[model samples]
Structure formats: structure tokens, C-alpha cells
Target: MFAGIEEVDWASMKHAYGPADDVPALLRGLASADPAERERALDGMYGAVHHQGDVYPCTLACIPFLFELVADPWVPDRGDIVELLTSIGGIDLGSDDEDEIDEDEAEGAANYAMAAAAVSAGAGVFFGLLADEDPGVRLSAPLALAALHDDPARVLALLRARLAAERDEEVRLALVEAAGRLALRHRPLAGPVADWFARLVGDPGPPGLRLAALAQLARCAPHALPGDVVPVVTGLLGQLRTSAAGPGSTRARPVEPPGQGAEAAPLTLRGQLRALSAEETAGRAAPWTADLLRTLHAGLDDRVAERVALLADQLRSPDPWQRVDAVRMSDRLIGGRRGSYAELVRLVGEQLAAPEPRLAESAAQLLAGLSGLAAPAADALAERVAADPADWVRTWPDGRTRLGSAATALARLGDPRVLPALTAALGHPLVPSELGPGVARLGEAALPLAGALRQRLSEAVLDERAYDRVGPVLVALAALRAGAAAPEVLRVLRGAPDAGGERLRTAALRALAAFGPAAGCAVPELRALVRRTGTVEAAEAAGALWAV
Candidate 1:
């Protein structure tokens, strides 16, 4: 299909990884009869030719060939080819005003402009593909048409018409999102598009469609957003959950019987496992539904209170996947914005007891990062920690056991109930770095574990790779005023290498200072460090010298 590919001077062009000589072979591989070879070729095209959204001279040359591949009905993964073209054309030029274009950026801007124009030239082909028989091709067409078409009027009109006739829920959602993006890019179309979104939101169509429209309306016209947006969204989400579980729902559809319809022959054990894995991956395969809600949450960016309320409703959803999505959104909101998230934090803490261990572990990890803000979840975290076996130290897939995460979260909130887990973790061969800090936070409450901490510190002083463990151990010893640890502290200070031991030396000095007069034997080493003048180690030594 790529008749003139060899006529081009590919050797003269440059891609991300040097030469563009491999571009032709990769293009030809896209038309391969075998799907695996086509996938490998597509990965190569993205990894090198248009690496990380960069459009090089080689990328521009490949555009015509890419278009040819998309137009060929027999080509596999035509949708992916369309997406790559959109990304290459979507470079942000910053400002059209010449005064804003500095000399250094001018050449790059010109290249971006050229790539965009080249992609825009294929708008007619994309428009025709909107009606392609392949649902995937149809789904991807609206985005390319909206993003690259030169005439915004025709693009918006065609998208509106497509939305009317589209029966696929996912495609209908894409058409709505594409129309919003087109209006946002072309300001003059905002008013009309906003009106359309408002009408769709009020329609008696699928709750999913209305939710998508509501989110888009918030984006295009924030002033037009209804006062009861939170309530409207909450109600719509409830309806969506109901519909998803009822008969005739796509999500509720059972897996096709072996050898049925479009699916290939009877399944083997491995095939059935793969099918189940795909269904359970990331909670659900239909992310667009969750994505629409996320967009609406982002559109109400300034209204933190409203966002928090919506999250509370979502966290309480009967749909486990929606709860998982809410936990992530709660994390983002708590981390980025200043708001009253006590209710949100409490809701997230409730997930610590979720039936699914993965969800419960995720909730614990989130709570651990919240610091003092996680106080509302302290009881729940404490309960989780207490429920674990005294020797619970099994490793999870991500290297953190459930007991470790829960205990860490509980200890961060100053609960002493985590003492057992922290103490048990201390004796484990592979001690968690968090154990030291968790013990340190408890002050005298952790005094009972001082002997264990000192023993770990002595053992850690001999291992060079145990710096992560040593620093926190020293801090915990200093916090507890463990007088017996002074010898180990002095040994670390004296034996630590001059080059990479700056932090270790500083922590030792601080620990000795906390020991007060009990650290008199460290005087000689402290004086030597003090003479290293004008450095941080010298300052820390001087402080310890005065304290001793």
C-alpha cells in the first residue's frame, strides 16, 4: 500500500533515536497479516519516530504513509495510527504573536506548525472513517476530526450529527467530549456547544450520556452550571449503578459461551484465566464512565466543598470499582487542595476494612500519606493493625505487607496499638524503614522497644547498605534518650567513611547531643569534626560538643 515509501530520502531525516532508515520497515509491518508483528511495528513507531510526543522531520515524512495505512480497511490497529497522528499534530505553539516567539523557540514552532498543517490535510479521510464499519475506527474518528480539521463549523456540525445517530454508549460519550474540546479550541463555537450540552443534560436519555454532557457543560460554561450540580451528579451516578446491574446492561452481560459468535473456539484453562483477568483488571474495563465523573470533578476545580461532597457519595457507592475510583480522587484532592476533608478522610478510612484485601491495602497506603489529616481514620487503622497476627510479615506484590501499611498509618496518628506490629517488624530480618519513624513518634510510649531499637542499630552499623535503617534508628534512639545506644552512635561516627557518611555523621551527632553528659566518650571525635570548619558536619559537632 505504501507505493512511494522508498522514493523518499529517509537516510537524510532524523527520528528520536538517530536514523529514520527503519521507518519504512515499521510502516510495512503495520500491514502484516499477523497481529503480533503489527503490534511490534506500532510500538517501534511510537517509541522512536514520534517518541514522547515529539514530531521530527522523519515524523512529518511518515504522515502520508500513516494516512494510507488508516485508509486501508484490512490494516490492523488503524485506530492507534490515527491517535499517533493526532498527538504529533497536537503540539502547543504557546502564542501566535511574533513578539512572544523568542529566536531559540522559533524553529521548533515552525516545525510544529508544519506537522499540524500536514495532519490537517487528511481531515477528509478522518471524516469518512467516522462512518467506518469497525466500531473502534468510528470511536477514534471524532477526536481526530475535532482536533485536526481546519473548519471548526463543519467539525462541530458533523460531531453533533454523529452524536444523534450513534448507538454505542462509549462512542456517543466520545462525540460529546470531542465537541467540547472543539468549542474550547474555537471560542466562537462555545455558546452553541454549551447550549447543546445543556439540552442533552436535561434529556431523558441514558444517565451516562447526561453525566458526560453535564461535565462538558461545566467546562464550556461554568456560569451556566446548575446550582445543584452535586445533587444532579450524585443522582445520575446512582442511576448509572442501577442500570449497570439490571438486565440488558452491557456490564451485566455474561461472557460468551466457548466457540460462540466473534470469539475464537472453545476456551482452555489459560484462555479462561486470561478472560477473567481482563475483566478484573483495574476493577473494570469500562473506564470512560469513571473518566466522565473525573472530568466533572475537575471542571468544578475551585469548588472544593462541592467536590468533597460528591466524593463522599461516590465512596459509598454499591459499585466496588466506583469506590476504588473515589479513593484515588480523594487522595488527589487531599494532597493538592486546601479544604475540609475530614469527612472524605473518614470515608477512605472505612475502606480499610473492605472485603477485598487489595482495596483495604490501598486505603491504608493512602491514609499513611495523609499525616495529621488522617487522624479521623486512626481508630479504623488501629483496628486493622490489631486484627493482624502478631507475626504478620508476609510480603505483598508491591513489597509492603498489609500489616506493615496499617501499623504505619496507625502509628503516624500517635496510636500505641501499633506497638506490637512495630516491635515485631523490628525483629524481622528485613525491617521496614518506617518502623523506626513509627516508634520515634510514640516518644515514651515506644520506650519499651528501646532495647530492640538499640540491637537493630548495632547490627545496622556494620552494613553499609543499611543507611535507610540506621538514620531512623538513630532518630528513634535520640527521641527515647536511650543512653545505652551512645557507644553504637560513637562507633558509627568514628567508623563512617569521610565521603558518603555526612548524613550518618550528622544523625550520630544529634543522637549524642540527645544523650547529654552520658556521651562524654565522644568528645575526641566531636572536636576533630568541629575543626572541619564551615561545613554542616562541623556545625552539628559543635552543637554536640556544647551539649556534652
Candidate 2:
């Protein structure tokens, strides 16, 4: 081996940097007489194999050497080396080290190895360290184990022991973090974790830890936490949940001078919950029901409004258990003096005008529920519905609350004011045609407004910005029974420029499909559109041609 090795060219050794032979050479150089030579050899070889971008060989060769370098006390600033250790296969801290290791090295190695193992679940070799002599290592091990490997039994046993025997504050806290992470993923761990969580519920370690425990309890198994614990978490989360509502999470009502009509008590959880039940049983007819919700609704100041909204959101939740509180809050807001039918319509209007669509949808649902029974309020909502501008709709976008929900809300409201808005929306590029039923549902209320709408569509059809408007317009046209606008539709399909005309052609076909034989001349245009774009527009046009 020495005969050929001494003569080999070192400068041109990049080709020989493959893991198989290079790993041994680099390993032997770890304790070379010249530190520069040792450092250079390891750095060059590690860099080449890792960056070479081949997954298998790089992982196999680098794991042990990286661990050795990480353990080497002589090497300072080991973050980069540790990160390298994690990037390939994770480091194995569980491996029997024949040499005795210091506490700091063990902790550092445990943390670094855990981070690496998180990427590869098969890094079970690190699991045995759950019982490491160092508390930090013990605490950190569970987190690593939870991520890289999954065995609820082992995790449960370690956590149980830590909960029982762990006396150090920091270690106890780490155990809580581990428990939350474990319980959050595997619900079965909730029993033991909840025991630990219950101990710290109000004891107060750190704000972050408490919040984490609360979040874990809320997310994993709310019932596992004690009933007393639930309210504390609810109160804290309620404060956080409602921090945006008004001024402060809790508000003080003025003390009455002996007789202010039973001086209204500040809404408490128990009372609000009771009212929520009454509201559900009584529905719109129950006299006491609406008042229950109103009490909570009245709590909405800038400080408490977020809580109010959160409560309302909960009332509206699809989950029956959550609905009681949400209903109680909503009833109080909508039916009680604080939230009454009159107030609800106004609130809905405010949400409609709000920049956020989610708020607008909430307002819309409130309006929909109140429709007819709250006829005067619905009438008022109608006017605002018409004035609100349109927004783009996408099934999947980067953000959750987009403008489409507001449009849907308006449609769901079915108030007449929506007609002019819908007609005006014809030019909106993002509105989808699927909204026709919603617009049409508004019925003859929309009929009287059709003439004015036709003029807007005609004007919009000619504008350059009207490209995206074309499809939605046609969809709305079908919605409005604006069949007479067929000629205008045909003209746009035939003559509009390519820049905006593509949508026009597509909308033209869709409109013609909606128009049927009444649009006989549109047959040629429909065929043209289908050939130009392979969309439903083409298929609808072909169907329309046959229907004609």
C-alpha cells in the first residue's frame, strides 16, 4: 500500500475523493503529525463527498468521522461540523463510546445528533440515551426520540420516570416540552403528559412553557386536562384570542348605586355557557335565550371585541360542543340589546365593508340567518351589498381569507341590492361564473336593475382592463337572463384583440352555451373558441352548438 500511496498525486486527488477509499485515508489522517495536513485532508474530503450530491455514499462515510471530530475537544467552533453531521445520516449518540466523555460534549453530541436524526426516522440508535446520566441529555433525548423514531411505550416510560423523579427545575421543564411534543403526536401519551401538565398549570415556570403546555393540551386532548385547568387555559387563550377585540381582556362594569335594575353582572364563563344553552333551545323564539347571548355581546369593546369575535366564531363552529358558547355569544350580540337584530345587521354591514373576507363571511352568515325574521335589517344590508366592490377568487391561494368569501356572502344574502353589484361585477376579472345561482337567487329583485347592468357590461366589454371580466360577465349574463346581450357577446368574441380577447372568446362560448339556439349565429364563434382553448368553454360551446 505504501509503494503506490507515496507516489500518488495529492493535488489531483479530487477523483479519488469517493467515500469508499477516501474515508480510510481521511480517518488515518485524523491524528497526523502536521495539523495543517490533517485539517486540509478532512476538510477537502468532507466537502467533496457532501457536496458531491450523492446521498448514499456520502452518508455512509461521513457519519462516524464527523462524530469523532465533534467529540474531539481540540476542535473549537463545532457548529459547522455538527451541522454537517446532521445533514447526512444523523449522528449516533447511543453508540457505546469506549472513551469517557465529558458532560458538555455529551449534551452537545446529544442535541446535534437529535437534530440530525429528526431527518431520518431510522436513527433509533440514539433512543437508548433517554436514561443518559446528564439531566440535559435525558431531557433532550425524548425530543430527539420523538422526532427520529416512534415507539410510544419507550417514550411514555421515560416521561413517566422523569415526571416522578426529576427534581431539577430546568430538567423538569425539558421533560414537559418532551411530553407536549410526544402527547401532541400520540394521543395515548396524553394520560402521563396531562399529569405533568396539570402539575404546572398554574405553578408557572416560564410564560413560553406554560403557553406550550396549554397549546398542547388544547390541541391533543382537552378533556385529559382537569376541569379547573381548562378554564385557566381558556381564560389565557381567551385573552390572547380576544386581545385584538378591544382594550383589555377583562373589563370592569360600573358598580350600581344600590338599584340599577339588578346591576348587570360582568359576563362570566358559567353564565355565558348557560345562556348559550338557552339560546339554542329557545332559538329565535325564546325570550330569555337572546338575552343570554346579548350579555356577552355587550362585552365587545375595543379591548374585549376579539374575545367576542372568537366566542362568536366558536358559536358558529360546526362542532356541536363548541357551538354552545359561540351561539350564546352570537345570540347576545344579535338578539340582545347589545347585539340585537338591528345591531347585527350593522355589524354584518361593518364586516361587509371590512378588508378581511373572513370577517365579511361571518357577517354574511349572520345576515343569512337573520333574513326575513330580521327583514328590516336584511333590507338595510341589501343596500351595502350593492355598494361593496368585487375581488378575485381562487380555490387555493397563498393566504386563507381572500375576497371570494365576501362575494359568496353577498350571494348567500340573496338581497335585491346585490343585482346592480353583480351586474357591476361582470367586469371584475376574478369573479367566477359559478356564482350565477347566487346572483339569480336574488330573482326579480335583480330584474328591475338589469337594464342599468346591461349598460355597465357593454361599457366594461370594451375596456382593456375588462379581459378577465369577460368570463365572469358571461356567467353573470346567464345569471341575469340578459339573453338580449348575445349580439354584444358575439361582437367581443369575433373582434377583441388577443391580449384580452382570449377570455372574451371563452366567455362568448360559455354565454352562447347558456343562450342555446337563441344564439344561432354564435355557433361559428363557439367552434372557434373551443379550438383555440381546450377548456370547459370549448366543451360547453360544442354542446351549445348541438343544442341549437
Query: Which tens-of-lDDT digit does each residue in 1-548 have in candidate 2?
Result: 12243343333333334424465465455445444444444455455655432333334434555555544445432333433444554344556473788885665455455445544544354455444454434444556555445576676676657556655444444555566667766777777777766666665444334545554554455565444533453454434333343222011111111122222432433234434544344322112222222332332322244445455444433333334344335544454333324443443444445444444455555655554444544544555555545442433362222224444455556755555555544444444553455556676566665564455456654555455444555665666656777777777666667664556656666666676677777777666755846676567667767765
Worst 10 residues of 2 by lDDT: 249-258
Q: Indicate which candidate wins on lDDT.
A: 1
List where candidate 2 sits over 4 angstroms from the true fold.
Answer: 1-142, 148-175, 182-191, 202-211, 214-223, 227-230, 238-405, 418-443, 452-469, 496-506, 516-548
Encode model 1's per-residue lDDT on 1-548: one tens digit a residue: 79899999999988888989999998998787765566567778878888877777888899899999899998866777887888888776755777877875676677788999999988689988877777777778888988899898998898989888888777788789999998889999999999999899888988888999999988877777889998999998888777754223222212332224426523444235535644554455345666787788778887899999999998898777778888888888888889998889999999988897767877888998987899999998888887875424556565443346677777787788888887777665556667656777787898888888778877774455445557767877888888788998898888776667777788889999999888989999999989999999999999999999
lDDT of each: 0.79, 0.49
* Residue pairs with backbone overlap in model 1: none
- Model 2 TM-score (2 dp): 0.46
TM-score of each: 0.89, 0.46
